[model samples]
Target: MAEVLGAVSSIVTLLDLAGKVIEYLKSASHADDDRSRLRDEISSSVAVLMMLKARLSPTSPHVTSLQTTKTLAAPGGPLEQYKSDLQTVASKIVPSVGTGRLKVTVDKLAWPFKTTEIKALIASLNRQKTLFNLALQDDHLSISLALQGSTDALGAKIDNVTNDLDNVKQGQKGMVHIANSTDWPELTVPVQTEAQALEEKRRIEEWLSPLNFWITQDDTLRRRHKDTGGWVFDALEFRTWIDSPGNMLWCPGVAGAGKTVIA
Candidate 1:
């Protein structure tokens, strides 16, 4: 953990130095296309390093493997190579404080790196940036896999809870019983006569619609043989529709296609 923390701190210092170098290049008195390219490359590398620092930081939610972190921060590793190359670039571009400074005067600064050297440094930074991006992507994949596993586990637990609740509801229904009482007439459930029932059904049908859906359903079922459409219930698509809420299953066909019978 301490090693990772130290690594994070080192990258922070590198980023700061890179920033200074970029700023100095931006303010150079002389304009060179190669110099601008070098500054852009340094800027891109700084972005990559910033991402690495986030992954290594102790406060980060992601748990990057210790081995991976150590490998990145290891001696002569990618980060080290980046630091060495970046410092070389800085020494050539950024002026020193004392007599070692390369400025011809207080206002005019000197450009020391040739076109080929600047191109070489840019190529080096490109390679290091690729490495940093790869590491961050690996961490992203790990986090995604972890979240998927948790979601699967939670779904299983929810299924178990749903089954348990169903069982409890069934048990309660079975426990229901009619108690014996001296006043049996008062306790008895009222039963409507056949004529009264028919009259009530007709009234409801008339109040709702002229067509009687219940009679149509009865006629359809009567014409269908016993268990004629039972195979429809066994279909995988039908089962999935039943399991999922707010799902609709449409069965479309020409006339006399058994659509109504199956439904």
Candidate 2:
């Protein structure tokens, strides 16, 4: 539990740093689109982290249940994964601003142009930010489902144990009933908490409906669009450009040339 808590804390701290980097990028000229995307990604990431943190809080009912179970199950691995992903993103963003790196890179560049290194850094950050946000959401859902399963299993075990002890001594049946009545409420708290967490996850997904729609639309376009045989070379070139670390990909064409479809 301590390890899990520490990992969660580290994720929060790294996300704070990532936010600072995004805020810095937001101040740069002619990068409004990138800034807006970063802002949305950061907002979504923070919201997810807050929800996870609430579930893991010391006073949370979910924590009480975990303590009673004598194990931390679902969230432990996911928290570690999130920690790793955040570390990767921080590694990319932090060094970009360290001790004259940006200034030196900008100074060596030609006049009347923004720093290519900085542009590439922002592109990389945005790409990783999107991937991390998606992974975080996946982990969040997995943890919630695991908690729900654990809660259900614990509830069943309590029922079975209570029934077995009740059968062991008929004379103590009334004592068993009293004990169950006293303990059942506390035992059910975790189950209720897990249910609440699942519901909250649902609510958060609904809140991200617009972003979800955009993702879905982008994926559909990717799948449905294809270049003609005559454009095979162009398609290969476009793929290579996307794979390269160089930032921009400009494909200008006439109005009816199907540029959007190809892209």
Candidate 3:
């Protein structure tokens, strides 16, 4: 149970770190090359972390849902790939910035920081990567213990652990929601404005309701087509004409030739 809680904590910590990195990326300005590469790395790390959280979830039905047939695995199937991606980003940034020199304040990095500050950011990112890897390792060990029947002695304690993990996930989700609402006002504001816009659109639609009256009903025509042998419509010439890119296909005939039904 303690191990489970610890793993959850580690995953949340990694998410928090990744969020900070993403926030920094959003606010900071850099050369196009550096900006694109850094953004890609950060986005990839966040995506992998999210998938890792889902895969590690104790309550997730998909955690143990393996198929017997050959199938494409989820992108972040092996933990090594996630770790390697993060490590690659870390290594790219760490050479220029020595470790342990930068202080990380929660959600409070001044935009457009100096070189030293950027170094600090990189150092923080590396620390997050290391911690994330360690957490994944701990989770793997926990699963091993479970598989080996070590957790059998815990019995009902397993349920408690699952409940605790769920609570933790809920708390993390709430925190993320709060962070997003606080950090990105645009998200919250647009929702209300969009609702208002939709309401206005509904009113306009109501006002235009009478316009629908001008449209003629085609149900009678449809019924006539159904009464007749519909196979005539599927004839090669008819199909060829329909498939052609020309804007109009005119079927000229005498009045009783069922032109209206075909049309």
Query: Can you give the TM-score per candidate against the true fold?
Result: 0.49, 0.32, 0.28
* Local accuracy of candidate 2 as per-residue lDDT tens digits, 172-233: 55555666789465432212244554565455445432123354345335434344334645
- TM-score for candidate 3: 0.28
Q: Indicate which candidate wins on lDDT.
A: 1
Q: Please, what are the lDDT tens digits per residue for candidate 3 over residues 50-122? A: 6546645678533311210001122332233334444444433332323865443323433343455445445
Please report, in order, the local distance difference test score of every candidate based on alpha carbons: 0.66, 0.46, 0.45
Number of the top-ranking candidate, with TM-score as the measure: 1
- Give stretches of model 3 more than 4 Å off: 64-263
Question: What's the ranking of the predictions by lDDT, best on top?
Answer: 1, 2, 3
The lDDT, on a scale of 0 to 1, for candidate 1 is: 0.66
Colliding residue pairs in candidate 3? none
Q: What is the lDDT of residue 168 in candidate 1?
A: 53
Q: Which stretches of candidate 2 lie over 4 Å from their true place?
A: 64-263
Candidate rank order under TM-score: 1, 2, 3
